[model samples]
Target: MTHDEIWRALDALAAENGLSASGLARKAGLDATAFNPSKRIGADGRARWPSTESLAKVLTATSTGMADFAALVTGMAAALPRGSRGPAARRIPLIGLAQAGGEGYFDDGGYPVGGSWDEISVPEVGDPNAYALEISGESMEPVFRDGDIVIVSPGAPIRRGDRVVVRTEKGEVMAKELKRQSARRIDLRSLNPAHPDYAFDLTEITWMHRIVWGSQ
Candidate 1:
């Protein structure tokens, strides 16, 4: 698996358990900073990977089987348990990132609205307002490729370090990791190092939705 995929899976696992990366490491009996973003890259600018022992500890602490963890890493829905599937495949709205910034695709709250969107069928999410966005640029590369589809949940609670799709009042739509959110400003970290990070005042943001899943 790719380095990005592995880290993303770990992040997903932690989020699934309602914990942060550091919290997951703590639960696994590892150093609290073991899974922090800063730890993912070495001081020399090389990628750092988690040890097998650490992975073992995390799986044991969370009671997660390798198969389930594999599902998260590969973004393969079939690898997950059949019983965990939604009642049926549901068609959700799908639109490209470029089109997303256009006028009619989303409402003020970031919910998919209008007839301009295409649709795709996937396992249902709890949010009826959930929709999918197709990646189109290199700004979020490696973690998300040009054609990758990310499921966005407007109703989900966003936390620090979560991947999110944000729309600006000026009609700019971009995806980045949430670094911090204050009453006045929101900070975002770019997934691609080639891109610049963002810090915008709360008023500059129209809506921000948490990225719940990725079709890697």
Candidate 2:
């Protein structure tokens, strides 16, 4: 497709996901300011195309594919139309990889609060408390390697098979599968096949956030 067409599709895809251009970039783990409208034009006034990597990142972050993004670029109704710039889809707070494991980045309810965080944008998540995290460790290998970004929705229900981020009172926040939960403790299955299942006391857990999306 032509460069302008691809750019337009990116625009439509952002709208389809209820985010502004910059918001989408931030959610993709890129600089929150890189996709600003001002940068879309060269100093000489020529339209610029988004870099290949940037485009791939946004697509992955939004859980959208290139084919659909192409349809969006053409104004086709392949994807549902969302608010052009919904505030909820444009203001996702981002926690750094290192800081995400530290204290004060998450509230008692598993929502992000009270931390120095960067903001990003993505499609509507319905929860005002939704946030993003950048993966920086090899612990969650295969499923999520370093540099991947995952979106967490605290308000979303935690089902049996859903992937989640759980924080313990001992200051450990980890991503795992919710195998089961009892009043006393919770059972977790690791994404890494070689890792064994874990059980943690419910009281030892502080909060948990269900992962809604990821860019890996």
TM-score for all predictions?
0.66, 0.58
Q: Write the per-residue lDDT of candidate 1 for residues 1-216, one digit (tens) a residue.
A: 777778988998898889999999999999999998999998999998989999999999999888778867755422234225555468889999988999988877788999989998887555788898999978898899999998887876676777899999999999999999999999999999999999999999999988878877
Clashing pairs in 2: 9-73, 17-123, 23-121
- Could you tell me which 10 consecutive residues in candidate 1 have the lowest summed lDDT? 75-84
> Per-residue lDDT for 90-135 in model 2, tens only?
6688976667778777766777777488887676556677788888
**Once superposed on the true structure, which residue ranges of model 2 sit more than 4 Å away at CA?**
1-89
lDDT for 96 in candidate 2 is 61
Task: For candidate 2, give the lDDT.
Answer: 0.74
Residue 209, model 1: lDDT of 88
TM-score of 1: 0.66
Off by over 4 Å in 1: 1-83, 86-88
